[model samples]
Target: MARNIYITSIEGHAGKSTVALGLLYTLSREAKRVGVFRPVARTSNERDYVLEMLLAHDAVDLSYDKAVGVGYDDVHADPEAALSRIIERFKAVEAQCDVVVIVGSDYTDVGSPTELSFNARVAANLGAPVLLVLGGQSGAGVNRTPEDLVQVYTIAHQELDAAHAHLVGVIVNRSDPDHLPQIIEAVSATAGADTPVWAIPEDPFLIAPSLASLLDAVDGELLKGDSELLLREALGVVVAGMTMENVLTRLIEGSVVVVAGDRSDVLLATLMAHASETFPSLAGIILNGGFELVPQIERLIDGLDLSLPVIRTSFGTYDTARIITQTRGRLAADSPRKFDTALALFEQHVDSEVLLQRLDLNPPLVVTPLMFEYGLLDRARQQPQHIVLPEGGDDRILRASSTLLRRGVARLTILGDEGEVRGRAAELGLDISGATILSPFNEELRERFATEYVRLRAHKGMTMEHARDTVTDVSYFGTMMVHLGLADGMVSGAAHTTAHTIRPSFEIIKTKPEVSIVSSVFLMCLEDRVLVYGDCAVNPDPDAAQLADIAISSAATAAQFGIEQRIAMLSYSTGSSGSGADVDKVRAATALVVERRPDLAVDGPIQYDAAVDAAVGKSKMPDSEVAGRATVFIFPDLNTGNNTYKAVQRSAGAIAIGPVLQGLRKPINDLSRGALVQDIVNTVAITAIQAQGVAADSAAAASLAASTTTAAAAGEQS
Candidate 1:
């Protein structure tokens, strides 16, 4: 059955675009022919609607029926009579597509309940499902209530159901990371299990294009703003069916038409040209389901000289356009789940309880071998590395293994009995038996191991029998390889705790003398943006000096990732805004670091927003360089650090990369117990980079000392 998607909102500024685009993107990936149609759009100029059509069109490569630009003639008529004709337009757009995405409009002035009715009317006419976008924020001054959302949902659902349209879910957008937990709790209290909540993250990319921006982009002027027509609300289009006639006729006067790329032909182009000429107030066209623009339409565009621009998008442009109009451009960063990674990001900012209820994902910061393997696989695709898998693999393991090897990411090592491993590989149709498979009970290791084992045993004052038994495990071989310079680093821990993996290494390969502690840093990468959170894994409750150490260590680590570290000592307060023991902890930690290393610049006792947002930093603690623009956050305690890092990840919708271990004596790193193949690859690269840095530093210091000695000797001779 075709998925009937509808876009709505509880109030304004609750990112409808983010949720709408996510659906469009995901569905397009599934190869569906989708359409978008808006029932009612109040904008007169064609440009206001062009961006939505263009983005959906270009981003997904979906061909759209030429969009009709809306003008004064269509909207000046009686709103009721006009709406009927608009509904007819929507029906026509819905007729040619499999899935129709309907966009909604808002009545910001008088709070007309009819605005809600209009959305229901469109959904009811087409029998589509509805999704509403809402907004919430932490701190006072923001008002988001369960009752408000419930009322909106209830009213829209009741009307749509009566009209035969389904209500699929609600998306909360643009929420404050700090208040995400509260908002989720409220949503759960109101929306029950049946209505899924997709909290869209704060994506400035989805911020509603300003009237001025639209005007500038299309070289058009806004006919109305606060005085004439309130531009604060969003516009939604609706597609009620898959028939072209139905979709086109149902299109409201100001609606944009979304057609699939594969479906764009002469007939649809003609229809769009006719619609644009007939309705002087039509929005542009959006191509849905990712179809490339054909030359025929490009020729038509040149011949007709139509004012309306065309946009190709994923899913169906018509449905996506409908959603753009339906949601009223109120989507925010912290809204409901619109993207896959979006859910992961929101889970971090939200309360653990509320997060668990909203999305069924709870990442235990525990590093497992499975996690390491997965990580290694990802890294393998991006770069070359040697990835090790545990003996006896399943389909999941085999698929990951095959992909990594085929991609030439890393050399593969399977630890198990050769015959059993081959059997398992054949069962899964994977020929990884060709990989270097070593048996734990191999006699080669047994005989050679006895020789080295005896030597090491005598050196360490132990018996040969005891040494042989102790080093008999496969992990022993793996660690020994690293010790013997066979492998650069060893990443294992799918079934082992961090300590379990680290213990063997600590005993066999001791730390460097200068190293004081072992800690970890999670490299949070958001596209081109990167931030580092340190000691999140090893240090539970570090002292002031220890935090200072973490700050220095994380900064150095950031340099390895090509990021300039402007450290922020994260706390609940901003520059002593609130006083508490926790605040004091951060303050003292900041002081100790300054005292210990006067050269290392660091600032702390600031909130999360200030650390990342330069504007916020400038506004709050104007003098501190690290306040609003900090890249590194040193948390007062592990509880706050771990939770805050994850919260920023989920709530702010940021990507959290590590728990990259730091301050190791050598370049040995531990992987999560549940690590993927990619994780292993990244850990290895990171270790290599760290090692390379150590090598460079040693060389530079030696060069400096040599130059100094030569200069001194020349001065004595003179």
Candidate 2:
């Protein structure tokens, strides 16, 4: 059966088209065959704009006529017949693709009192999960209050449930950032844990009216520049009536300036602003009031290479501005930049992996290693982070860096001699120009870093000279970059031992205050699921306290990557079936986790079979929550964890994407000496995600401190 998702909204212009486009782009990267079906389009132009955009990007193979369903008028005339036709059309597309995205009707002039009911029925008939896109602004043109958002979610949920369709998730689109936290809290509380909620902050660029859109809205005549150039987006509008200096201040990048055509001075100033480096590039200029420029001025404009579009409108500046403001830019086929902006917005705001999981369309029943790696790359690219690779001299590292850069997963800094690195890249036929190359020994900051290093290790009697020598090592240099916030994170160990790779981080970066011991986890990308195996690369034999700490750290690492924290403390026994020192250690660790972090779902002293296979798990430990659904596994010792991860990697042909060290103040991951190019790419992605979490935590701490200080001052004043 083809898994389908219906992208629908409560009203018109709620950004459902952008959401559908973004989802199609995301799905195309993972699935081989994907198609789109708009169940009820607004027009009968025989050209679907959404379908054309997808085809322009080569995201889909279907034609526009085949992708579109009945028109709005047809659906309005006969609802039942139209729905049946919609279902049939959906099935036709489903037959040709592995997954099909069904776009719901836009609530417009063909509006019926039963529009919502009609949409719900279509979704139910198609047996597709619905992703609801709710506009953040209410009818009052202000940010929706928490109560208002909750009510919207409640109404949609009730309607979807009534139709017996799954409400996969809710996306609060075009939201004001200031009101997001409260709205998110309210919606989350009302929607419950199973339903995910995401809020996308308003991006002016995404919704900005293009020059072409403005011209069409006001019925203006183009006086200069190509019609194609006029398609460029105008992020803001400036009415030029003030002095040149004042007007220049109001002109932002991609802004259209409206002025009288006879005001040649203002026109000349606008042209100069576009040409100068001191001012932002203008999107276009609108000459209002039916005034034409003089022949000399027109000749002057022709003499200059005027790239900005100039439009002549019969209306006044105020009326033209009003028309432009009312124009909402559509994602046309030729608007590649706008498409990119929409994709970035959706990726940044919508958690695609979680959304796919909710739609039941990803991590296929038979998950190959390729699918696992694709998921990692997709997740990493959603929010690119800077990751430094210390083993830049290695061929594997260079090749992986090229792949990472090409895929837009992470920005990288390779630590090596620039000449040698470029030469190596040339030899490998790899383009690594996107990565920053640096030599630790030749950098101007070597001495400054050495001084900081001495201060960090002064308790251990580190002299300045000793620190200077140590800072020259690439591992130490990369770790220092992370500590000083020059780089977000570091990945090493391809050319060094695990101890050599992580020692600098331990000495300088240290561990988080909440953690007593640092540990490691290998993300075992199994056939059907990704599992976290911890204390695998560090801590040879930890005591019960350290084991408990490892479990906590491993759970955190798993959660960071979107994996649910169902922890299984692995051993030879299944729930007291055997007795030994190792088994006792696992039991103690499980007890500690329950006491210290009761929020985590953990069970222990379970065999591997019981931890993975549901039938065996039920037969062995029937009452355990973590037994069959364990996504994170904590072994008793390095001998078990390391050997188990490798065994699984080799025997099952799985992709092991880690040895990601956890509980560090900063992220510094290690790769195997025999790692492949893809392995390095995966590790770098993991490090970037770890860095993002650390940064977020720091920001939250700073915000809390500022709030507390304000409260204290207020109390004193009172």
Candidate 3:
């Protein structure tokens, strides 16, 4: 029989969907093939989102018709018959996979007195291990203390025992950040040594409903605004009951404003405020009472391009607000934010090895995009470092900071005025509590940074007065922090040029002892494998030796990220098939690599097709080991490297991450000017990993120097 992970929750809105998604993700990482099954579904006409998300994963191959069993009505009608049918259906799914993840029925209807028992019974009959989930949201009258969590776990454990079901794990979702440690300790003390427990702090963004869900809840019609804005989440709802001035004061980021359709003044003011940089961005606008925008007001705003959603609903403002508040966030496939947040939270808190050890799974074979992303975040979190984002004025930075803090990926210091940064995040309804907001104008830091800067640049005629003023820039201030050992790494370029971001680093940190120049590589994540493309972001036109150094550095970088190293010296031709100065330079670079690093697998003057395609590689260079499976590609120049990476990224549907800089004394990365929030997150994770590598190298160098001194002292004594 295949191993099964049964995820069950006793109450509604316990955030089990996220847990189920998380478990499926963890299992898919190592399991050869996985299956998802829902023994019972909601009584409503809509499909099960949790099951759909699981089946949508690249790891699963089952269909909806085959994955779902009976419904709640059938269970209520005949429990025995329903259980029998569920088992029969579940076995069919199990027959085709190495393991299966069974999502227990949701507690939608509160009337079922024996719902928890039913879940336990189902798991026992199916011979599956249960991973019980408890809701830990604490607020107002719903105070679930550490002792309260224990009591709930005790009851759930009793249910599992009575049904003879094995309890292997417990998760406390939506936990209070302040009491997370207490909750985990209390639960673990009672959950027994055999069962591991994890707790994820409640994230406001994860719990907030996207505008799409709110639109559906109110039966809204898109009146105007961008369709993509529907994906923006609504943190809360505001009823425009009063005048425009009063509503403006009540405005907050991700708020859905509900007003009567005839409130032209309110509508116009809200639209104007959203466009202004000083005001908070709304999730959407709902015009209730079955009214549409009037002709005069419509004409006034028709020429203006709005960025938020404006929906029209027939219900009154009061009714719309009520419906919007009850709408919950779904772990849908299209909802990338929720998906990433859930996976990050799970990987950070849960010990997947314990669960995998119980399953006896095999090692992973293929490197999918999702798998690569998960690995990056996991490795970065293992030794979390302090990374500073210099462009704190950007909204994307604030959003990314929230995600980083919530995921516990790294300690962050955002460089900006504390009041401005805090106020901006508040207007946007983001919780960036964990990040330390530092101002570039701090007197002590400014003086210290200025002194160091003048000292480092004294040969270049740098003045103390000039240095003091220069250190007030965010990029300079942040880089100085890294140089002073306050932060492990720095990531910039969201609001500045590449030169502006890295100029301070170049002046202060400089290159490593062995490296002559700093170059970069983009981790090209293909469908099933990841490739490295170097010199794509830095070095305009490198010489033969520089190209060889890039290949060597690229190889080391690939190792850092767990990618194989089969270097391909990309050129116009394969081997000696074509001759030119360009091809000759590649050949020379290839020879240099072979002479320096004889252990590394490398091939020269190879075309792109020959480097990647098995048949082409075999035909071009039959004797070469690196031709068919080259994971690292060294481009001759920036022109070719930049265009080629972009082409492959678009054509192959690959996720191009980073221009991750190599050969630096410390880890400093740059981002594109138009980077997204996810792009920022990926770059930060890469920066953290680079910091870890830098630390290891420094430690090794220090140990070697100390040993050499000791040896000399011993020789003198002899």
Candidate 4:
């Protein structure tokens, strides 16, 4: 991959952060060691919000001290010295990263029309490609025609050419969606087919300032309500002056309501509307006019459990409204909703993958957690399997579903009441319209599932009536969907126990013919590389055969994800160092793995340190190939495996992803009840990849059987 790229805008307020965020996320998927830098920037009083937002991503391992260089004033005072300093700082970041994203200055220093050229020169010096971003919102507002955008592109291209910077792509962000086709046609013809060109429509939600920005703009204080709601975006401003009936009717979703402090009628009505959910959900309430809350109003607001962000400003209603209208939105590290929306919009509009191909982002040198996670998503997306989420009631699931749908990662079927799921998603301002919402109560589906359940469990004395009721359980219904080919895989357990999520799989999906019992593994993502730990979530204490099976499956799982598997059977002893029943069990398991899969490289009766540490391995089992550098570790029991994985996860600061159930005839994985949205996304991606692997296995088996049949026919004819 091109290790460095510089993103610069043609003018101020060009939505460059939207373009930078998209490229950063795209680079994150392409490489694990991604870096973001700002060569020249305006140092804020508190912090750099854009750099902070980029650093907040897990894939970006950079500190503010390293990501930024001299200030705009410094660049203005001494251009040569400032460029040198910028190069020095950029090199420091580049030395540590495989690929870097260099975002241009914020253009906060007004009256300096040379800022764009300065940024281009910096990119040329750094040998980075330039991605020029144009402010389509300004153009669209002025009713600029398609030729206007093409003219903007021509000028930007000329500036970059003057600086000797390679132009890789062009993006017209904040453009009108209705005018995208004409703009793209004109720009693409000018940009040339070799250079990619895309247009991102202006999203009102993205451009709307957050409640935090509004509060700052009006110099306000929180009089009551949740402080967290300050992060919500204020899509519109409602200056309440009319009667309560008129004001309440005018209230809009995500709008900040500003009224005089004495307007208890409006306040009470807004509170009632918030409680009823029949009206629009507001961002918060802003009260001005310097009037203190009356005793009755204070008592009334205090009596309620309020969540609306209520702010008090010294300015009157009109002044507050004026200030709020002028406040533009910002992309801050704390605003996840904005980042999500920005990424979704960018992915929807930008052809970043094609641009990367032109830049030649080859495979990374080493496998990292970020790289592995991206691999799972990439594989799943290649085929786009239909994965089912059983826990539709969990907010995290729904949010992750929106992300998945937006990214086009997988086709999802959420098991729940259609109305309830739709209502919840709308209330949360989430767009999950792309997902398939299925309810367990659907009569036709329930009976078909119930009949299948009976066919699978008839020997267990399962009756039609009982099966019908049992299949109505979401977990069972979802698993049945996979079993009947309605879905490719299943991801659940955000609201249920591991057994509750996987029990239906055991009864219906069962294990592969070569496998006796199902097992699970945790892909421990360390800073540098990814390793596999097995039997950590399932099988409390597997005997020798089961342990061997876990080892074999864990290795295969690791290999399936592009991790090389040199097996290390962990124990309390290393070779002949000690003797005990536990060591002996591990030794026997090692022998079993060798007996079954001689193709695998394995070593057992080895201490944890020896299994991982090169020095310890040399001192203990110098002749063993798997004594050190083993990518997959098989734990003999759950007590040791679970505690060890958790300790490493917390102490070493690793990301533990899974309880990825293996050996299943079909793919079914479980999630921790405390799983975050990104965690759910990763798990679902893993489940989809596992589904791809299963299909491949079935296809291979069918091909082998057909060849055998043809050979038999040939022999009989002869």
Candidate 5:
């Protein structure tokens, strides 16, 4: 039952080590039996600390005959022997644990020596998921050339994928606070959002390992910092999980003495005695069974001068070692107060502010009402400010509301009836005593809606009863609330089409009067870059005028997000390379934009790469500002826009954000039919900001127009 998780790095010193340790430690806290394997090793000194910790903690379970340490010398001098030996050790360790953490070597590219590839092969052999680790260093975000990061990631991904390892996510460790925004943006732009990036903050505690601590804790050595041995962090060991023979070898050569707490004393003694030979500078021994220490074993350990730190836990040693292997330390950037330490740590490492901006707001822990129900919502409500429910008033939403309110996510609104709402809530496990419920049936508002309904109905010669009946549905009420500024926003469409959800808003709120067309834009965020893609959701076949409006709207959106506008009107053909209706559409759209907004920099009839890649743009249209370096792309139409955006999202491994509604009188946004809770929260926040900005701009523009009109009238009168 061991889940094999791989730990890799994009480049050297990105703190994959710390990430390995943290994940292992966290998993250990959850009581999962964990083991670890390293297919490659460079330094025996590093090996000593790593192995010693493994041995002392009973952190690993596999038994190996040969020593646990694999050296760079071994790799160069006897690579085949080293690889086979490491692989064998890994197989032994894997057998005894429920999960295995595969620690990656420093080789960032494909030409990984046999040792590294074998480690990946071992992960595949054990059928474990891979969690790639990347180190975080201050200024590394802007300092490291983009090419370097891309190359590193591309290689790491290639290796893991080639090994057929199921990469779960990435851990960006030692994340600096100030550079967080840039980093998150970069990673999102580079790696895509599907790959979760867990930013591990630097912990001073992990950095303060004394020489004595090193001797007693890990299986590593003084590389260059031997004089600062006391300052070293104990480098935990890697024990393979293939079989008993492999386990036995690790027991002997591994510096950290590890024995499954449940295993017989003879086995513990066996591993200890074996490890004592190669790793004479052994740190400590770990007992895995959560058992009381035997005095005789303790005396032997003390006499051996192998200072061991014994962690008493019920989890087996193999799993424990896997967890330990991932418990590397973090180093955050220097900060002198301004926030609570934990929050500061979160801000420094997680970069909450940058996360907020990159995510368009604070990330929400969201849950689905239909699937997870109260259980899911309860968990989500604990961390976020808003709770979004799917369109239905069921028992789950009400029950979850009590938890939501208690957790102070600020707002909890359901998607169903006022009449049956309380009953549904009561039917579920909801405590509605202190809950303030709002339903679609506000009598006063209902009456007011009836009046508006009658007028619209009168225009159509419909009766009062029919008019009242038509206005009673949740969609109508929800739409009215959004238009009337009663609620922040409403998400509908599980039982409705995009047109159905949007039609109600169009009827009530209408498009911005100045704007000829309302459109949608998709935000494409890759590793560290974000691109705005317009006409992706709306305007299936817009004319020149509509295209111009779409361009302006998209450019405005980019500006809102601090992206300098470089507009590219995309088509199937690049610069008339292919001529057809599609090419004509793009050409006309580009011309219309230039005519309407001469000041705006827009170019088109371009391919995807040409629009985004500088090299491609330079070759295709040397004189065009947007040809090779556009951040905002205006697709010819929704078919091409939607399809291309999705293709990029699926194929190129990009995160597609938004179908952010544009040219609306107010900010009314739409969510995906299968949107997560965080998606809802993020869309809402972005929409809110968009709405407020539009409102302010409208007021300013209107005032300016009025002033111009007055002056013109005065001149005419004179």
Candidate 6:
């Protein structure tokens, strides 16, 4: 039977999702088949942000419906059936996984006086060990003493203990860091020294509402500035009723200044403050009273390029202030920063190894495709890189750019006519305002880029005139932007040929120093796993040495994307079973790979079936580790690789996320000519990740673990 652990909190906004996400991540590192289940939901149509985050992070494989239980309405209508449905769904998840992380209900809906009781009943029925989370601050604010935390935990423990559910631990979440030690000491002393008690310090970024959240709370309308700015965390809320000097003194970074719409002086002062470095940056300015700004002030605000979000609400200043204060922070799907921060906090505070030992969960290694993609997005957002999309005229490109900006994936520079792009965006109802739109044909940029291009290709006898004409092309211009350090990487080919897209890059950016040839790999996201198919879209027919290089490069790409590297060099024959030109080439390549990269687990002259099918692989090469469990497959030629990827994509119903080109000095990815919006988005994200120069070094992983351990140790000391 799969080990089951239920995560429940005493009340809403108790940071239950943080605990669940942290547990899922921790368990996923060891568990091959980890599943998540939410026993009850607030609404039927309400999207489960926890489940979405898990899926996005590649922590769990269960679908939303199976992972989440019946809606509150259905449960209210028929309690018994709802419990049965939840149990049935949970069992389905449990049967498929080594461990199941079940989440209890949030007190989202009204008239739920027995939410805790309901959770306890479900925990008892599931016979799962429960990890109760309690809000450390309590109802008053962050003034809760150590005794207050212990009291809350004691009450929760008594309730779960009475329900006959095993209480494995208690997590005191959103606690003041300054008092974390006292709280933990108290909880341990009172609840029992042997019992596990973890205190997670409150993170302002996690608890603070974004400008958009505040806007929604007040039902405000966006009056000026970029909507993308609304995603900024509102760290402070200030009502601008006082004098300008008083407001300035009180302002902090990420402060939301609430003022009446007619308060032009306050509005102008706030904008100027944001403009000046003397004062902290303003997150946004909220205009209350529904009073329209005077024409001159409105024009002045519009003419200036303000990065701060400005919103207008119908409510008066005090009411708006009250609403902003009362609005609870939520973990939106787009907020990767908060998710990462939460995960980091959990990892720092909780000892996952101890938790797993208590839960009696021992899972094996299983890498799912979703997990791979999630890692890609996570790494990309860790340090956002600048990416340029040259084919901004295309609606798909525009849409992808908007999505990237909204998700905080990358800073984008879309190469096109600003007016035309904006017009197209308006027609499509796309928000590309966050993106920097640059005209490739702009005289000044064209001249500057031409001069740089001439200098770069001057050895080839290229003149300024020829350079000027070349730089006019969006591809050349975009590539030049990367070359000039204006952008980190570029993604094009939506309306251009492969040669046209890669030509400028090859000319200007060039390949890495160690790489003799450039190759491409399609991250074949199959039903169960993510496999790397190498040289799929680049080299037509690589020599033995080139093939070996491709294998090494492909392995690095796999590791960069969080795919463990076990390379299989594909041919028509397995081992020394056959003697042919193709087999000989693969055998030579395999030898070179072994010679060059001895640390890499690579085997070659292997047939496709033997590479993938365990039974066939064992029959052919019984002692080979890379044969059956190959996560990276190296094809002999482009024809074979391209055909195989397309066939598997169509026949197996796979979602192939790449043909992600590798071995450039800087990242420059090409998209399929017929690529959809999501494809572009994924490609752009991949490009941004690649630009970060993450390598395939186990030392890097070791270093990260060391840092996490160090942080945990520091926290313990504190």
Q: Each model's C-alpha lDDT?
A: 0.55, 0.82, 0.87, 0.86, 0.56, 0.82
True-structure lDDT of candidate 2: 0.82
Displacement of residue 499 (Cα, Å) in model 1 is 2.4
C-alpha displacement of 687 in model 6, angstroms? 12
Q: Write the per-residue lDDT of candidate 4 for residues 50-110, one digit (tens) a residue.
A: 7888888888888888999889778878999999999998899999887898889887866
Best-to-worst ranking by TM-score? 4, 3, 6, 2, 5, 1
For model 2, the run of ten residues with the poorest summed lDDT? 362-371
| Backbone clash count for every predicted candidate, in the order shown | 160, 0, 0, 2, 104, 0
- On residues 559-653, what C-alpha lDDT tens digit does candidate 1 reach at each position? 77666778888888888788888788888888877886677668888888888888998998999978776777777778877887788778866
**Which pairs clash (backbone N, Cα, C closer than 3 Å) in model 6?**
none
lDDT of 3 by residue, 521-607 (tens): 999988778999998988999999999999999999999999999999999999999998999999999999999999999999999
**How does candidate 3 score on lDDT?**
0.87
Q: What is candidate 2's lDDT per residue for 477-499, written digit by digit as tens?
A: 99999999889999999999988
368: Cα error in model 3, Å: 1.4
Query: If candidate 2 were superposed on the true structure by all CA atoms, what would the RMSD be?
Result: 13.4
Off by over 4 Å in 4: 30-32, 43-46, 111-113, 139-144, 179-181, 223-225, 243-251, 259-279, 290-306, 357-362, 415-429, 436-455, 463-473, 573-581, 615-624, 695-718
Instruction: Give the better candidate number (1 or 4) by TM-score.
Output: 4
Q: Model 4 — TM-score against the truth? A: 0.88
In model 2, which residue pairs have backbone atoms overlapping below 3 Å? none
CA displacement after TM-score superposition, residue 593 of candidate 5 (Å): 1.2
Look at candidate 3 and tell me the lDDT of residue 138: 37
TM-score of every prediction relative to native: 0.43, 0.55, 0.78, 0.88, 0.45, 0.68
